[model samples]
Target: MTRMLLSVERDAIATAARRVMARCDELARMSSSTEGIERVYLSPEHARVNRLAAEWMREAGMSTRQDAAGNQIGRLEGAFGPEAPALMMGSHLDTVPDAGRFDGIVGVLMALEVVRMLRVPTADGSFRSPFPFALEVIAFSDEEGTRFGKALLGSSAVAGTWDAEWWNLTDEEGNTLREAFREFGLDPGRVGEAARRPEELVGYLEAHIEQGPQLDERGESLAVVSSIASARRFQLIVEGEARHAGGTPYDRRRDALLGASEAALAVERICSAEHHMVGTVGQLEAYPGAVNIVPGEAHLSLDLRGEFDGTRDAVWQLLTTEIDAIMGRRGLRWKAREIHAAPAVFCAPLLQDVVRAGILSTLPEGVDDPATIFSRAGHDGMAIGAITDVGMLFLRNPDGISHHPDESVSSGDVARGIQALAEAVLQLNADR
Candidate 1:
């Protein structure tokens, strides 16, 4: 393992990390929102970043192209040829509203750095691949689903899981996905061409920020991702009678807002008790703006996740029972509509070992093993896992805050992550 993950110079690591940081700053300026970052799917910002990423990938000695689904792809052919199975690495470029600079952005840039470090110059003044398999770095265009309410659109296309129904999905501006595709200079009819066959990929490895506080709390800079959590999202509605707030007696009134609030609390309580389970009520709204009227309808969004599917579903069942009881006591009715669901994507054992070895290579003399974690946040791997084996490395984020402007990663961690991920790629080559 140590032989596979050869030591990288500290200066090289720092230089790669600085380039990544500077690129991140450049991308931050290409946002849709004036106040904070808001680059969404197929937007002008997305186009700009794709062009920029392609330029950087070219500088790293890879030929670049944009896929039919709008994903930016850069390919460095191996000794076998252009058709050879390739090791793929990348993450999404799209971000949630008011997003952090280092969520998915860092992964794409790190992959570019890895390619830069590995690409060899030939006598003909052309770049040559150092390994038997090619290296492909991708910048997925729509992993956040910020514009169209469907996450992983870019990765799903690459995984050959593109849904035709998604063509009708509309953005906030009422532009259909089909229209948006054409407007972005892509032919929707050709989107299927973007899908890659399983034989084309050796495997996929991604490096991303932790998006949580576990590594920080442990005083660690990086971790091996064991798995990504299974997630389910729902829009819950609570219905009750609308009546005069002042005239109705306490016992006679049915308050939907209060019932929904109680159910939200129940979600938190139940999930907290279950290991690796988490539930959040991120959105809530009550109908009837008048203060004098009892709220007849309340809507809330529930985001539930767990390490395993069974445990996550079981917790949801328990929450349903508890919510039923609460609504019964409040004389309100409740219903839930599942908005999105994804099964957990576990890292392949081979890739996990490689990533672990990579992390160990960057550790001090006395350290033996790297920390392992299950990601609570979703990633493009969840979609790409349908086609090929997937693995991930995680860098620490302070306080575990994500999807906000305050989301941050340290320069030292970024340097370490670049070395670790590059070493992981080399380790993979050796293992092969």
Candidate 2:
């Protein structure tokens, strides 16, 4: 059996993580969304973050460049020639409104660590070491899609699934995605060129915070993700007669708000029927929302997630069926729009095995045993897995809160994650 070649410096990893976390705070404050820190799509703040990432990549000895779609690529060449399949790793830089410090930044910075570790010279002035595959750290743009109501735009483009029609998608201010790209010094028409050939990539890996209570509850520093849950979203609009709240008798009035409430309740009931299924009414808007006016129309956004596609579809069907029945009986008009959907992703087993072995080997001798868990959240690794082999390692968050300012991970946990990642990468390239 080949021994793992783990040479990462503990101090170096910690310092790099702190540096990245600090940068995360800075970026968050700069992009504060209308909801709070809105670095949506090609916003000015998005451009600024991308430039900062490129500069950091260059400082770490990687040759960096931005693709037509504005996805930043930081390349670290291997001892082998360009023909060798490249080992790619990275996550998005964008975040939701009022997002926390870590979210996507941790994975990008950890990938940078791999480059930093390989570039440092040994005591004899020799290059540290080279792997068989070149490494590329990519900071994907617009993963949150908070601006255009579309998520995973950057990764979708790279995967050859970006729709050109969405280039004209405008924000609340009527600024088209293309216009924003131009303002940010990017060319929108060339997005398709960013699609990468599968042969060029051997595999991909991402290290991120658990963003949930799994690892924290389990007391594990590292979690090898086995799969990512699927997500489906629906938009429901209920229309009823407008009337004064006092003038319309409750028995005779067709209240859109009442219809919306019924639909929400139905969703909750459906989710309760299945294990691992979740349904949420994240956004609800009443037309002419007023203190004394009966709501004439109500719009609801339903977000559903589950471990399997069938479960997600079942929940969606249940909602639509209930909505139809309620609308017909209450004499209210209703319509449903399917917004976004992605199937559950099962990671490459080989890569996951490597990650598990690495964590088990490098963890402190007396620490708690590590656990492998399935991720309920979708990640860039989900898209990458569709194109090439992909694996993920999640660090334990103290409170399992992510995407908020309070999200945090302990320094020791971060260190363990770095060591495990380094070992995994080295093991993957042992023969080189």
lDDT of each: 0.92, 0.80
- Segments in model 2 whose C-alpha atoms lie over 4 Å from true places: 1-8, 32-36, 119-129, 364-369
Tens digit per residue, CA lDDT, model 2, 231-260: 988898999987898988888788899899
Error of 1 at 288 (Å): 1.8
Q: How many residue pairs clash in each candidate?
A: 0, 7
- What ranges in model 1 sit over 4 Å off? 2-8
Ten residues in sequence with the least summed lDDT for candidate 2: 1-10
Error of 2 at 351 (Å): 1.6
Best by TM-score: 1
Residues 77-146, candidate 1, lDDT per residue (tens digit)?
8988887999999999999999999899999999998888778888888786888899999999999998
Best by lDDT: 1
CA-RMSD of model 1: 1.2
